[model samples]
Target chain A: MSKQVHRTLSESQVTAISEELNEPDWLRELRLDALQSLDELEFPDVIQTPGRTWTDLSKLDFEALVDPEGALEQKERVAPEGVEVLSFAEALEAHESLVREHFGSVVDPQENYLTALQTALFTTGTVIYVPEGVEAQAATIRTTMAGQSLFNYTLIIAEQSSSVTILERQETADEGDFDERYYSGIVELVAGENSYVQYGSLQDLTENTYNYGLKRADTDTYATANWIDCNVGSRLTKTSVETVLSGEASESQIVGAFYGHDDQHFDVDARVWHENEHTTADLVTRGVIDDEARSVYEGVQDVGRDAWNTSSYQRENTLMLSDESEADASPKLIINNHDTEASHSATVGQVDAEDLFYMKSRGVDEHLAKNMLVSGFFVPVLEEIEVEELREDLNGRIQDRLAQRTA
Target chain B: MAQLEIKNLHAKVNEDGGEEILNGVDLVVNSGEIHALMGPNGSGKSTTAKVIAGHPAYEVTDGQVLIHLDDEEFGDEEVPEELQTWELLDLEPNERAALGVFLGFQYPAEIEGVTMVNFLRTALNAKLEEREELFEGDESEDDEDDEAGYETSPMEGAADEGEIGVAEFQQLLKEKMEQLDMDEAFAQRYLNAGFSGGEKKQNEVLQAAILEPSVAVLDEIDSGLDIDRLQDVATGINALRDEQGAGILQITHYQRILDYVEPDHVHIMLDGEVVMSGDADLSVKLEEKGYDWVREEVYGTA
Candidate 1:
């Protein structure tokens, strides 16, 4: 692989990535359209942040990071029966007719960097489609990211009255691991009328990797989506997760937790927009920061004027372990409808001194006391994750991180 | 040979040497003996309790605190390093608690997330593990039967199956709470959170009763309690002493609790030390003459 620089999102770049993956004309057209949208749209003005520099594209080299085109690559990637997993290139060729229906529906190319990579140069992606009224026996699709500095798109659509659970785990083992690579990705989830969808993402990128991700879900006509995100890796990560209730009696639960140590910088921005009547949403996000690590979480629960009886609540809490560590929590709620109920709460501080004192008064040493307090801080978020294995794994990783900081 | 001895104890609130609060307090509380320290407000009774519990705000300028468990002596340089001495004069609060010392705070903080069951189970298991290690091999058949009893119950099956279960501990806690007349439902809620003053005091007593420390220090348990609730707390304390053999160090400004619980000895704290000692009749005398008379006659106060 050459350490060549890939500059600009042009037809050539799109063709290079598309041709390398052997993507069909439809996927190529989608990529080109997404890239055009990315070039035409402007960045959002939600917060005051520094502009994105070109150095952030170090991980998207076409020749070095991507698989060759039309290499039977999708056929080699296997998943459980009835739970299909195929790359965007394969799906664009084999199921090209249905590609237009699901691709890029949740995250528009106009919305920041979500679709820009796909628009410019998309090598591969995982497309998950659950047929109407089909329910998963267990967590169905387990998507694995194995390459270094990889950029992937995951599009999941649960048809009317269908239910499914998707768990995505990103890992790199060996020479292919790009320590300083950048991973920019997006996930689009849509639940049709009376459907239920649960998507869980575990991002444990290498210390040298920088990750930027955006995920959104649209619930229509009593549909429900439970999105659980656990971020325990990467040097710097900026993520946005949202759920839009677009139908009457639509509901969603968004649970997110991030544990960072060392010099890691992580930011999570989430928004839940209730665009229809009788919609409801629940959001709880927690972060534990140690050493010189910094974490910022910004969340908003917006209830529109047409959304009557809309109930929503957002809570963001951060526990800082070291004197040098920093955490910023801002949970905002914008309510345009007077009849709707919306509440937001944000807390940033060390563990309660009284709590520490109480635990200490019971024979638990200072270190164990802090551990117990930190564990309790994440209990609610962890409990929201229904999968036992994933929950325990998350807890173990958090405990290990805490131990390292204390050591 | 259970004894809690305080010798020439002195402490101040501020690190920069503020006013001397507990000045040369000398006292000894032995097993089966309930000693009540009676004094007026700011007489250093509460400070003595806090100092013994290893409150960080206070610095021990002089003196030592010795809590002897059976034949083992704590807080002494003479004890061997492997003997597990608390060094109460310099120990942290948890270390003191682990050393069989318990203090019922006058105002226990309402911890939000720590449930009563979780806190009590952790404290109990720590003590249980310590005792198990100490009393290995010489364990009694009754103790074995109790362990087997827990082994037989399907309730402990969850724990035996590898999950961190608290069913056995919850059962023990329920029985203890029943003794304290505390609602069993309260045990499922957050520890002392949203509890009323009387309920909070009862909670403290409940924990003391459950943990069954070698030495129990109750500060102002009688304050703000009605006669009925006072009698309930007194009954719970009496039960704990009779069953657990815990030495009671009751710090109260009123003689009302002594009327029901019946302390074996009463000490009057004037400045920081015990200024006067007498039998239970002293409580009656203090009730009749009041703290004013004691301050005037004992400390030469006008």
Candidate 2:
């Protein structure tokens, strides 16, 4: 229809997508404004030492990778009572005021270049709203991308005293001639006072794809937010999960995992900010890489000056299955308040031979024992996943990856 | 009867050009008997146990470790070479385990995520599969496979008749935990994670009880244990020796654990070689006289 739109974007395409979806004038303006911010915003910061810069994102030519016209359809899902779950477009149409109030409030759409790009091009997503004092369970969705590119956003709003569990999964649909597709997704969650929100997602796209994701949540007074983000597929992935304890005595737990094999590279980051007193945060991440694969992890726990009596702990471990593979971890604790209790630990090493030997001596096959240990390494974080199906799905995918590595 | 015979075994570390640790250490333990290997630090008492376990870190330069299994002692799992005795050197650690050889570690490795119940189930199922008694079920496993069809047979070895399901595994774990005097909640914890020294030893005994190995090599099973826990764990070891009639090769630097387990025979090892052998009194003598007299008696040094 329009010269088979290729890997570039213009203001016209953004306006056209908005019109195709029948979006309100305010949304169109938001998209166009995000488009304007792209020229000024830079990609997520990568850790740099004197000799090397980890996870180079500058090489990602967004113009060449972003197929602005290609977007996947969001699957419909059933929701619990007192909870409203709808496709992003449907939510915008039926609950425009509600959508406008919470959108881009928790996660700044113009925070980084990737965020700006996502805000400008995302055409498919889901919106979940749990009303005050309603406990909603089991809201799940799976997005299978079949096109050349995909950009999606998920917004979750939990009202005061409400509890909700949301699980999301993403993967490529089929093996197409265009092996190098692009996928970008962003999640914004707002937990109201005393509300509990749990968001878990696993991305296992084809190895020929490039993936980018930013999931951030903000918690109100005495609220809790938990995130489980796992990645096992994709040629290159740059994903980040952040939580801001904006409410006093709020709690947040970020549990993350990734497995990379072949030439796949994973740039994973988990950060937590303590903005209020007596807030608590726990960040745990584990990864395993094999066969020339590489992974870089950065975990940050920041306690603001006024956020006294805050407790935060961060732990990150990466296991290299092959000598050819590489892994790096940087866990930092920035505490501005003297009364805060903060600690961070990062370790990168090969599989523990003693642990393996112990399992093997117990009559487990060496290959299977190694698989168990690798799977076991992810347990501390996996235990944080409250959704049983998502936990099992993530585990099955990890076992699949380990089996492939063995083969 | 089941027996583990170490014949003039000579072994060395597999790394760094193989530093010799076990030198011509000959030993034997038959079913329904407990033999304590007593020695000072670096005397290779523990090395003998590891060498018999086929630890990957050690390579045997000469001699052999042979496990003789009788139909009365071990179930009907076809013995190789058409003989009841199988040499241990060629088998992997797990294979050795399937053949009814268990190694009780001195310092058990702490593994996360793998609960005690799950690990015990897998290990017991591995033993069952080796004996061709495991239930042949693939439905639960197939649900985990993707459309591309990846097979993750947890207990892999010859074909299996079946795998113990969850409920059955829990029942089995409960019985073993009770038998070992372990609390019910202990089975729910990650394998050896944050376990105390005595708890680790007790866990090893619990694994041995569940797997039902014919011969167990205990390497310093009493290390760091207090008098109460040493007696508690030794009682479990005694049950394995009496209830299953399994052979016990108790390797230790101190003889305190032997007080409760009670060895039928005690052997003193000095400088990677057995210097003297006798009844349980040998341990008391070694404790009183220490290794200097043994070195003087054997190498004319003291």
lDDT (Cα, tens digit) per residue for candidate 2, span A220-280: 9999999999999888999999999999999999999998999999999999999999999
Which tens-of-lDDT digit does each residue in B156-271 have in candidate 1? 11122112246667778889888878888897676777898898888888888877778889989888888878888898888768878888999998877888999999999987
- Candidate 1 lDDT over residue span A260-379, tens digit each: 899888878878999999998999898888888888788989888899998998888888988899777778888888888778898999877766766666655566567656766776
Q: For model 1 chain A, give the 10-residue run with minimal summed lDDT.
A: A67-76
Pairs in steric clash, model 2 = B134-B161, B134-B162, B135-B161, B135-B162, B135-B163, B136-B161, B136-B162
Report the C-alpha displacement of residue B34, candidate 1, in angstroms: 1.4
- Model 1 lDDT, residue A9, Cα: 39
lDDT of 2 at A63: 55
**TM-score of candidate 1 relative to the true fold:** 0.82
Docking class of 1: acceptable
The best candidate in terms of TM-score: 2
